[model samples]
Target: MTDQPPPQDQPPTPPVPPGNPQPQYGYPQAPPPPAPPQPGYGYPTAPQHPYAQQPGYGYPAQPVTVVAGSGGDTRRGENRTIALIILAAVVAIGLIIGSGVWYAGSSHGGGGTAGPGGGKNGTATVTGGKEKVPANPAADVLFKVPQPKTEDPSVPTAGSWLSGRVYAKSGIAEIIGYDPADGTKKWTLKFPGPVCAATERVTADGRTGIVYQPSMPTKTSRPGCTQVAAIDVRAGTELWSKSIGTGEFATQFRNVTVSGNTVAVGGSDGGAAWDIGTGKVLWQPKPGDGCSDAGYGGGPKLVAVRKCGTYGNRTLSIQNVDPTSGKVISEYKMGAGIEYAGIVSTDPLVVGADAGHSASGGSGVSDYFSIDNRTGRLLARIPVSGDAYEGECDTISQVEECKGVVAGDGKLYLATKERNEKKAHGSTNEVVAFDLATGKQTGQRAAAGDSFALFPLRMDGGNLIAYKKPPYDKGGQIVSVDGASFRSTTLMELPAAGADRDLQTDFQPGYSEYRYTQGKFFMAEPNVGKPIGSFDKDRNLFVAFGTRD
Candidate 1:
């Protein structure tokens, strides 16, 4: 999950003037040695080795007098002793690194025993493989566990897998790794303060690392989310960190996101992009440029938005750029009324836009249109109306909101509110699919139960992952809807862990912090508003769902 970086307890750093660049920070190039396992986060503790308890004296130094032995023999004997000491030192160092690697990786859904460094030290005692999810969504149960929590439920939670463990940031100030086999703590990396923005990315080896900015709130007189850092997921090692000046209005930037080889920070005044492998600033657009703010689209493109013209007649330019060089590749312009315009898919060059307020008050509709990716010519348009288009249900209500438009499989799926006599919590809506090429309804509607609430999450295994929760239901249910047939099947039922009672005022389920990245899925609810004490332990419920092995 992400936001503008949070404020720090220390004083604010001055802003770096527009042209001057900030210094970059990076660690030595190594194959990133494994992360050292921390205590009590569901990782195995290091065991006490037998050699550690031995006396300092090595090999009980035997007295070898040069005078007592033959002259040539004495020199050779002394050389052999020195060589032996060096060999022992090398072996000892290897053992230490090996022990750290073992503790870091020993908890991947398999039983592990306490090893050399675990006993007396207050390190965490871990048992792995307890929690597991089926490889297929059609199976019995993926998994149900306590939700990992964050102080602010509004903040997004991002997930990744490292060393066969699930690493996620569910709470502020901490990024945790869980054993997906069963939801158990694998390891946790606690920041010095709360984190404002955090994101995780998996590399080729399946190892994931998180790039985050520590708590440096932007509301203060000296506003900035100055420090951006990356840590290894397996061992929490600070891979690299740097203070890139986010200017004054840092909160405008969205969560730190890693798309491909670049990790980007968004802001109204033109954000910055950095190479994920190295802490090098790849590019940053000058503020007031036609396209200032940017978000990642699929493939190698980035969507950039900027506003121009006078108050009476305003124009919004949405441009697609080459992320590696920040060069504008294609541009599309539309009038001011269209809001929330974003590129939803790459192959079809589809864009979604909504107009919350029209000339005659608010227009209760959201539009989706496809354009030629290269020429920016409008190809097709699809509009959805009803309560769903008005941003779903109510502003202050605790009901699950519907994600109106989702693009998948060369078609645009729109969730519209259906006028039905039965009214409960969640939307009784029909999801209609439109052919991307012609904008005509396919005449297929996804089967929705009487209690179906609308929230299309993402495209999973060629199916759209939808969310449903009936009034007074035990827990939310995740449905896998076939994009072609419009058939909906209940995949798994989310447990009612941190759900609030439906006592009118307290009924809105704020569990929107769930995420599906790569192949891993994790969702959790907020436990505590502010962490108590060490930020180590808090009773929270979270579940990790994945395909069965």
Candidate 2:
């Protein structure tokens, strides 16, 4: 079905086609706009633009021609060259302006672009929508010195913040009001006796603060007991003062805690809560023996750290006391073998700690520890060093002490102290942050800025860190490291050497001390005596004292 075509001999006419290829018509004659700022764009050798053949001052626009036969077909030669130049100029100008703006921002800094603190740069390039918190070299916004209005500053009470500001007893024995600004003397109320080191225990609520006077056990039928006093912050006055116990427990003071409108203190006999203003005993539970420190989860709930027996049988006595009616709504026991067995309360989840059991009794505990605030359940237990700080878990090893305090983040910061076995004469300080929910190390630990000791106090919540001051030093400062990474740019040299007694926290989460004042960094020296006073940190001021005489 295919037709055959005759084969033709090679024709010589093809040689004529090589001569003068007729001026290409309607062909792409223009090279790209100055070839752009691209990698491989340049005028081809011998040129593609028709202007390459033109002899002129500047390359003439490729000759545009019209072919009559084609009816105005373009001889497209460098036609778009002008357009390319203009476009590039516009882009160049835009880039130049942008670069100018960038340079200006970088040179002048202070446009709020870079915070003096925290972490930020000007241009940012790209940062999430976090405005970021800035820091100042000066903590002065929250720190002001209270000045003296009376006969020079006389009494330095351990200043504390309850519902409001309170300055506990000072030496020569007195409780006075120190201004939250300038450490000035606001008012003076004399107390009964000489306060001991960390002697004055205060329990604070949202609306009030209570101070307790602990009793030193005598060799009588009883050992010692504690007294209680409640102060109303808004009204600025002592609401009530009562002797909570008699016998040996007299002269003994328990942990005083206030939540909502009631204040509570505990003892070996039982624990009691009282009305905020009336001093009427709100709820008093009997047969609560060996009870030491106590606290309440806000509202009508109270939990006492009870030392149940002579052998370190600790118990979490959870009680619901009616602040309005002083009624015991509920009661329950949490565990046995509790040391310093108080409730680490944040509501719903109550974490507490205690010494499980002591074979004998010269008074030594496993370590300071904490429990679930609600269930009285055990959490991670870290080892504690001196009675200076609380200890925790030794279930697996004796080196476990719940030292570094945890904030509400369920992050427990534990500080471990041991007489460096390597250098028995020297000691080793370790602070580690652990996830309470998992009991695993967060892998972050803090030590001394210098070669010193780290004392950790209680933890708050998502924010804050706690640490301790080195003992035996003349004037030492206690550090509470709770912030994710708390770093103090400035730590002033302390003035005297005496134990920091009045420093404490209100037992809530994310709560910051505002560090307005400080207690004596170091306890008094053994042979040489130190100042006869203690200090307190109110809002932002240090309410302290010394004799004008």
Candidate 3:
């Protein structure tokens, strides 16, 4: 495939702006030592011993004194009192040294507990030797890939998958698989055009779907996204490629996904399904009704978002359908005035929408509806204000593209907007959960300590995997919060200084792809384009960090 500029009629959407730089922290100056105990006439002459230095940073040498009394029984009481005072001083010095070590560890990338409060679950235990929490968690840069050069700044490059020991990343017009540990290129799958849409969900066997145009677009001619292909990421090869319709009436898919044995693609034109193994068309959108499938959410189950009615006045129906037959098993109709709805999950049947376009800050979500997929019953309508929570949904044709929110374990987890702390100079945030059945806050909050912001990545069994955007002078961290107790354990920490630290913090949440498996954390740009200026040659496409275990 060749690089192409977007058509004149369809302008490219600008990417999200980079995040503000965080303030760096420096070690505090040590305070002066306490004045030596004042001597009095009643007090015995100050006894002095050799001074011994503390074992940590910023601590002054401590003096150990021995009190000797030549006076007889009358001085016994005074001797006893002096001994007690000396003992107290020794204990205090030990505590100060211990505290110093802890502070130093936390400032660096040492393993430290994080959250709003402690939990009853205690420390998490490693299961199957995967995702083990390190005692002093720290990660080293595994590799980085520079952004591919492109004249057009709007070329889509949004796809990545980790299969077996290989990491496959979408480039300008190709998918390349690289060694997960090193930066060696394993294989490449070339496409005829840039990838327009890609699904994050991969089949159990490492197969995924993507939509692209058949040829490159030029100044005068631009092609529609009519090609759909299934790739076996594990094998680093394309399984099959196909398209539908012809000429101007051809269906241009906006998104693609895989569910069971079916590869589904949808758009404003309509929806269609095909067999994954054979690439044979299974079903197409039926006519007679004004409704059309806007998009689909695929994983475990396939749910379609069907839009009907005339423009400016539309209704949406959420359908749980059989993947192979395209049969609607259950349906829930959304209220009018909701022009678009994004699916947060297919199994739990959670939908997010901006009702009446009331959402602010362009989050594209004003509320969430939790439905029972089996019976098509609305369990609860949870109101989420854009001003308080940080969740995003694409207002375009991508229905399953949402960020900053994760739904699992019968709960919807959302990250709160970052805010300045009342007692500190840096900012902080928290991840709060809402009960899907009741549509109420669970009162459980996992905090991202001062100077850090937390965003939910995905769920691991019952736990929630979260990414902690680090403050300046520190490295980003991956944490796992216990589902039952809300306790967080650090799984991996990135570099704290040098070029690695700069690269690690460059990929901000909500704007980049973050994947953590085993003990490795991968961050890649979802879309890459030409830099705005001539001096922006240092742009990167992908960076990986892994624990030193």
Candidate 4:
């Protein structure tokens, strides 16, 4: 019973079509901006990065690699990236403290050697969390490039860089020296054009941060041509720029992130990196590839979800890309019932939601896994509980009524889906929370019509954020739960502002159930939900909507 709601007169996909109208999501639709279709619950290759991964889990032993080059995901949700050897990984050190295990070497082992500009010595820290960033992380070396010279200080103005926020209280968006605390503007700086996506990266300096902005493709005739701009948090100006794949024919940018002085990106052809300051091309493969995955962010190391040619009747390829040189270091293929779910967290590692084919090859298997970027390892994995589908009476068709799993912090929390079972049995459905850290059952809750599986809210400061769907009579308040203690609290109704509303409106209501962090919390509204995934701690939890000049 996939949580997909049946549209008006839309033929229900396979198995057993639910009896009546779309059950759970009781929502009205309005003409909004046309939304990209829910990313086929996948990217063509593997998973894209925002340097975020699913949390509450362990790492995987296997790496997901396809031949390479990923594209497609109208349903591409708000996935972001981490960048610079001025790396986010070092900032992510705060994350390892909670894993309950500290070792002499990272699962990926002595991180990959730094590429050009990765530091005169080569190599710096970057971040990726969505995939199983295990032992062999793609080289947390977000920067092999050297740092740039300081720019002449100037008055704050539009285009200057701000810390994390996009605009100044003065209503001006800076390219550098913009402060998040106030609307202070810095120098006049325009980031690279047609910014496709952007995010905040923690730098070596307390006041310094990195932002990666990808521009729209131009009408050129190159194969790989794109620009990645690195801005100074204190000054809001361009530190450097690198031309990625040709921008003309291939305009789609898979992911852009900064790890220290390095800026990595997965493009329509392959993954590439540049020294944040020197603007040196780090690495490039002979044929080159777009990236293995499409939803995660790109940095020193990039995990791609690719479709290696049809072999053995399976098509998915998962591999790690060296963003700097564009060389693929690790690769593996995904087959048999595995489908890209969504990102769990952004820093420390990458996370994913994957479904396996059932015994009948129809009923899907729901499990979650965490990846260590360096090793391409699976840190943790948790399968859904049997009772997860036990509620519905009568043989509920696997199709038309199956609910899957969502990952965050090593825990694969799945909402219960039993066809008319709750109503038939006069019982409420429940949500089964599985602990992937130890493959143990933590708890469960009674629910009704568990439709679109709600994902984890987010985890920070050892606290996990999530939403309590209404089927169980729970308020849609943003709930906070202690990671170790499993304590829960209702934060707020969260602001539904920004483009998220537009995206949400595209689907039936009963399907969405995510609780995460992106700062921007208010005492009166301490829970302003961001549109994208925010897993790393350095990422300031702030609020933002489309901006106006």
Candidate 5:
């Protein structure tokens, strides 16, 4: 039976009715059972009644059209641009090898037409895990937008930027935007308290805006996080901010995410949805509602997982909600001793269920399950076949961290690490492709060298981009894997670092991570853990490896 809250008490057995009153005096009445202990820690003990769909607040009858903007290099000087282009071409010809498939009726058929910046005119097809690489990826580094000056530089909001070259980074007190091309100040938006997380994207109105949440000064104090705001991307002004009455602990909230014009914010207590353009609160979880962590899925679908029952046995509700109205559209239930569920993807609705494996011993694997977001039916359960070595479970934020697991070109790619007998330490990383619909392993390939593990970056031009795992020294190289044939080709070796120091492993602003967006790749190399002073030389830079414009 679906778990529900204990029924409410009936009005105190209306005083013994006249005739029965005499008999009641002789016979002792049973004392009423103690009311179920009030819900603990704000979470509801009972299941929430699925709400009916209603007209969405401050939304149109039809879906709004969202347009993505383009990004380009705005040069600081003509000489510098020309020099970089020439250097890019030289590097391409020397380091990059063709994938061996070219268009018809061209003299440079196998090689393809190389633009001035050394990017190919047409795509290349290669088998055996090969990639078509450009000559000089560093030539695309337009400029490095520096982090802003603040009183306390220790804490920085996870920085994000728009394709229009508007870069944003937050300090404890404020969030600031900058032009990436010339290091010019675009705008700054200050909050009453510290900013927790920030996300920005182009809106349906053809403008960019940022949704940011503020953290409480004292974490122990109740109600540390009560509000979130939308800031104009270019103007650096607040459009509107709304307060959620969830007196939840500040640490429980995830970063704000923007899907279309709607922004969703989730916390430990519950979640709230708001129209980004207007500050109208669409719908929020009422007190004692079991639902938490509301997030946007594909289309008008909003997805969240709710938990009930007690420690040992728990039931999870995967809810598909209306994004605009915050009404529960459909619910799919999964229980039978499932305790924790982490969301990996939302479009086809991929969720990773923790099988209660500790990081210490045993397989320590997570079971990946795919569900149809619309129908709320289980599609497939991809068994855990890989060991928890290289590409294994790290704390969840989805693709950003575990670049090893990716969904692209109608297929799912996963990188697994296995213990190698030959090696004294370290394991071998292998790439496995699976059919998304069938959950069948299509092909498996190992990284070229035994020394380094391959971390799948992002898909570019219908190809998978992967790189050697860190301690990324001079020998590290970037390889592109073909989507169709599963072929991989060495693109280029990484530029030499300043010096080899203790490698920082944490994923943070100054830490190293590979990111691909808008036909460009960024490798964050920070000067932390070095001899650099705390303020003066504590610089963080992103090396933009990009294709020719």
Candidate 6:
């Protein structure tokens, strides 16, 4: 059974009476009785349902026309005119922020065009196994972890990763690893308090970094996120746990990432790094010049977003730094009025920013700046309106957590906002590419068929791995799109009926974390809230689907 909250404009309905038989998905028999409510913090009033689709972040209602473009460098005068229009719109609307639909297209280029054939074939590379695209793809329920109880509605549970044969997930104050094939528990790592932040990347040797508090929060005392630790996901053990300072003088971190052998973290207290293997402090923040490091982006390379200047009048410098020596190799200074910038990719050095606060929706993007990281030279500035594109980023502190967009193979792949079909009844969407060098649409697009919305998951070699959200009665699909030819090959398909469909549809792409590997698809909630009522007590924290029985 599923529980949906009322729309924001309406009042919530009364809870269902007891003794009503709720339909159970996937499970052949009735679900077991609700577990005794666990002791945790949250709210004392009625619970807020977390599964209901919110308005501001996903598909919009009506579709607008995309702007036409020719693909190349946009003239300076044209750029100034576009910026003025965006600023005027924000002023007129008073900075509207939510998940709303809007159509977007580059004014410098026409629609995307297909590339040449003979592109590289896609492959699914897993640590312990190989996942090949099956001729007739089908999947079944592999396992499900029951949701942990909490009194508060908004608790932090923002970390998950797959290592070797174990799938690790975060809970209130603990991390649990489970067997990938079955639902049996492999190991558990407990923490003193809730996990404040986590990196989505894992090292080649199966090590990852996380930030947490030294102790649990209480009514009279609240602890800061000051501790950093490196854990072995495959072995389910902590390699090292350390922190600098204590009490009020300690440095509090809002983000953490693993780059090579360095575990870097940063926030309002500035930035710091530690050796992953020895737990030695590599460098500490130097206070002066009214400048501080906001955060760092890791994976393949290390890039820092440094902020300097007074309140409203500030400048940002994107710096490519060495992980061991903390030396800046190259730097790119952004234009005025751009307060915050999110790192999309380090190697290609793609940055997303809302110039003059022109972005309407909560996507935290108005234009993409592609730069030459080695030379610190500007490559191309790609304008992506939030109204038309479906990418997201944390414009505040977490610099590297962008989603719904992929940067690979010298191009940027983005999913267009879902629009109603002209000939069909349901809505559909498409994936388009942009050249990082010319800032022009590639003219190649991968259609999502009727009634499905496509989202880019990750890059597989030269191919693009994407997820297709199914309609009300159909199961979701995973397909691999050729990077050059734009052809899609079905990799796996879940069951359309029973409990599997219920679990699949419950975890949407933008709001949940998905990992597909070795013919298995894993969906886990980034955070868990208090159950709305007894009917929702059986909601799972995570669910796994596999091609094999």
| Candidate lDDT (C-alpha), each | 0.39, 0.31, 0.66, 0.31, 0.41, 0.66
The predicted structure with the larger lDDT, 1 or 2, is 1
> On residues 1-549, what C-alpha lDDT tens digit does candidate 5 reach at each position?
012122222222111111000001112333322222311111111111111111100100111111111112111111211001100000000111001111112121111122222234333333332234544332234445334443332333443444456655554456666665455677887776555444433454423333233443443432243467776666667788766543443323434556566666654344566777887776554444323433333322446654443333334556665566544545555534343454545565665444433222111223555666666666655554322322332222211122256556655566655334253244444566656566555644434344355666656555666765433343344566666655554454433354211111222211344554434444542211122254434444343444453
The residue ranges of model 2 lying beyond 4 angstroms of the native Cα positions read: 1-159, 162-173, 192-227, 233-236, 243-253, 285-301, 306-340, 343-407, 418-430, 458-461, 467-549
Whichever of 1 and 6 has more lDDT, that candidate is 6
| Model 4 bad stretches (over 4 Å) | 1-193, 199-225, 245-252, 259-261, 288-307, 310-333, 336-367, 370-410, 413-432, 437-440, 444-455, 467-478, 490-519, 522-549
Q: Residue-wise lDDT of candidate 4 within 327-380, one digit each (tens)?
A: 445433443323233233323333332333211112223343445444545555
RMSD of 6: 13.8
TM-score of every prediction relative to native: 0.58, 0.48, 0.77, 0.45, 0.62, 0.78
lDDT of 2: 0.31
Tens-digit lDDT string for candidate 6 (364-428):
66677788878667777776656566776665557787778888778888887777757535777
Q: How far is each candidate from the true structure, as Cα RMSD in Å?
A: 25.2, 36.9, 27.2, 18.4, 19.8, 13.8
User: After aligning candidate 5 to the native by TM-score, how far in Å is the CA of 53 from where it should be?
Assistant: 43
Q: Output the better candidate (3/5) by lDDT.
A: 3
Show the lowest summed lDDT stretch of 10 residues, model 2.
91-100
Give the per-residue Cα lDDT of candidate 2 at 19.
8
What value does the lDDT take at residue 357 in candidate 6?
A: 46
Per-residue lDDT, model 6, residue 99, is 21
